[model samples]
Target: MESSERQLRAQMRFFHDLVRKLAADGDPYAKVLSAPDNPYPAYEAIRARGVLYHSPLNTWVTADHELANQVLRDKRFGVRMANGDKVPEFMNFDNSMLGLDPPDHTRLRRMTVPTFNPRIVERWRGRAEAICHRLIDDILAKGGRFDLMTSFAHHLPTAVIGDLVGIPEEDREQFHLLSREITPLLDGVVTYEKSVSVHAALDGMAELFGRIVEQRRADPREDMISRMLPLVDEGSLTMAELLPLCMFLPLAGTETTVNLIGNGILALLRHPEQWRMVAEDPELAQGAVNETLRYDPPVQTYRRIAHEPVELAGVTLAVDDELAIVAAGANRDPKVFPDPERFDITRSSRNDTLAFSAGIHYCLGAPLAKFEAEVAYQTLITRLPDLRQAGPVRRRGSFIIRGLQEFPLSAG
Candidate 1:
C-alpha cells in the first residue's frame, strides 16, 4: 500500500512539473520534452539564452559546443547525484553502467570494452554485410516499396546484437518486441499508461534474460552472456549487476543503430547530391554515416549531474545541480563546423560531433553502430541504386533518442 501511494505521488509530481514547464515561456528544455518533430529550433533557442541557462526545471542547460564538450568530459560531473541518490525510477536505467559513477562504471565498462573495440568490431563486418544483404533481399522481394525503418533499419542491429549475445534465432523476434516496449523509458515516463507498459516490459526482459543466464550457465557457448556467467558465479559481478547489463546491452546495441541507419538514409535521400555521391562511390558510405552523425544524430540530449560546485563558462553550478547537454545543438554550432546548417557528406569537420558523447560514458557500442551503418549504406547504394522516398517520413515521438518511426521508401 505504501509503495502504491509513493508511485501515485511520483506520478502526480511528474504531471505537475510537466504542466508547469510546458506553460513556462522561454524554456527550451520544456519544448524538448514535448518531443517536437524538429527539436533543433528549441536547441537553438537554448543557445540564444546563454552558455548555461538555468532551466525552470532547476537544471543547467547548454547548447554551446565547447561548453557542452567541457561538461561531458569534466570529471566533476556524473550521471547520478553527488549525494549518491539514484535517478527517478521512471528513467528505468538504474543499476546499469549507464547509471553508475566511477569505480563501478569503470569496472563494468572495462569488461565490455573488448567486445566493441574497433579491431573486434571489424571482425563482424562480413557478418554485418551478410545481414544487410539478407535484409535488402527481403526488401526487394516485397515489390520494392517498404517502410525503411521496420523492414531494414531495425532488423540489421537486432540480428547483429542477437548473434553477439547468443539469443537464439527463434527467440530474437520476442526479444526485440520487449526491447521496443522498453526503449521509450529513456525519455523518462510521464504518463501512468507508459509507466505501466514500461514496467511490464522490464519485467518481461528480466524473465527472458534470467532464463538465458541459467541456460548459458548449464552449457556455455561462445557468446557474451556465456563469457559473463563465470564472472557472476565467481562474484566478480553480482546477478543484480549481470541482469541489468544483459538488459542494457541489447537495448543499447540495437536501438541507437536502428536510428543511425534510419537517420543516415533519410538524410542522404533528402539530399539528392549526397545520395548521388554515395551511389556513385559506395566508399563514401562512411562519409555519409559520419555526416549524418553530425547533422541528425540518434541521440540529441544527455543529462549530467554536478558532483561538486564548479564554475563553467562564466556560470557556477551548485553541487548536485543537473545539466541538460544538448548534443544536437552543439553539433550545429557554427564555430566548430562551417556552414553548420548544411548537410554535406563531404564536410571536412564532420567528425567533431558529440553524437556518441565523450569521457567515461562515451558510447561503448559506437564502433559496432558505425560499422553496421557503413555496411548498410554501402549495400543499399550498391544494390538498390533506385532507392528514393515513396511516402511521408514519420519521426519517433522522442526528443532525446531521435530517429524515425516510419520512413517509407521504394527501390524503383
Candidate 2:
C-alpha cells in the first residue's frame, strides 16, 4: 500500500512539476501560484493585471481586498466541486470543518464553537504564558541561543493543543513530531515524499487517537476529547466526524499559531523600531500581533469554487470554477490599508486583516491563536529584551501556509 501510494505521488509530482515550470516561466499569476518562496512580487504583478486576473491555469485569481472579501462571503462559491464532491483524495484527509459547506459545515462548526470562545480562550492565557516562559527559561539556560521555531514557537502550540486534546504527557512529544510531519498537507502542493510521510503520520495519529477515545470512554475527563465522547454515544456526531474533528484540533491550534509567533517575531526583528516599540511597552503586544497578522499572516491563501454562475469583477464564473483568494495579498491591498507595504504596529485598522480569513470560514481557532500569539509576543519582548536573529531563517516550502521551518535566534 505504501509503495502504491508513493508511485501515485511520483506521478502527481511529475505533472505538478511540469505545470509549475511552465507556470513559473513568464506568467506572474502562475509564478505567484507556484512560488516556493515569497510570492509577494508575483502577488503585486497579479494585482497589476487586474482586481480579478484570469490565470492561464484556468483559475481565477484575486488580490483585491474587496474581491477576496466578496468571494469569501458569497454563498454562490464553496470549497467543494459543483457536484458537491470534496477535493482530491490526497487533500481530503481529516479535512474536518475545512471541507464542508452549508448545513454540514454549520453543524460541525457549531459543535466546536464553545471550545474556541473568547472567554474560554482567555482562560488559556495563564497557561499560554506559563508555557512560553518555561520554553524561554529552557532556552535561556542553554546559553541564550536557540532555533525559535523548534524550541519555542512549535512546542508552545503543540503543548497547548496537547493539553486541550487531553493527550497523555508521555505521548505529547511523539504527537508533536507526528503533527509536524503531517503539516505539509496544509500546503497547496505536496511532493511524493511529503505525501507519504503525511499520510503515515496521520495514520499514526489516528491509532493514537483511537486509543485515547477508548480511554476517555472508560474514564472521562474534562478535556475536549472527553467532552465529545458523549456526543458520539448520543449520536450527535459519528465516530468518523468526532475523530477528524479531534485531529483538526492540532492542525487548527498548532501549525498556524506556531507560524504566527515565528512570523511575528521575525517581522519585529526585521523592523527594529517595531521591536523596540513592543519591547519598551508590553501594552503594545496585542497591536503587534494585529500588525503581524496584517504584515505576514501564517496562512497565505485560500481557494473557493463557484457553485453556480456568478459575476465577479465583470467576469462570470461558471459552476466549478475555482478562485485563489490570496489573503496575504488581500491584507496588503492599498485600497483597504494605507501604506500597505509598511509594517507599522500602530496601524489603526490592523485588526481588520484577512489573516484569519473572513465570512463563515473565518478560522475557528482565531481567538485562541490570537491569545497564544499575543501572550507569546508579550512574554518574549518583555523577557528577551535583546533578542535578535542568530542565523539565516528558513521558510517552510508551502504556498498555502506561510511560516518558517527554522528561525535561529539569540535571546540576549
Lowest-sum lDDT 10-residue window in model 1: 185-194
lDDT of residue 154 for candidate 1: 88
Judge candidate 1 against the unseen true structure and give its global Cα lDDT, from 0 to 1.
Answer: 0.85
lDDT of candidate 2 over 42-114, digit per residue (tens): 7888899899988777779899998898778888988898787986665444467778888889888888887
Instruction: Give the Cα lDDT of each candidate.
Output: 0.85, 0.83
Question: What is the lDDT for 23 in model 1?
Answer: 37
Alpha carbon deviation, residue 49, candidate 1 (Å): 1.1
Best candidate, lDDT:
1
Q: Which ten residues in a row have the lowest lDDT in candidate 2?
A: 87-96
Error of 1 at 341 (Å): 0.5
Cα displacement (Å) at residue 385, model 1:
1.3
Off by over 4 Å in 2: 1-11, 90-94
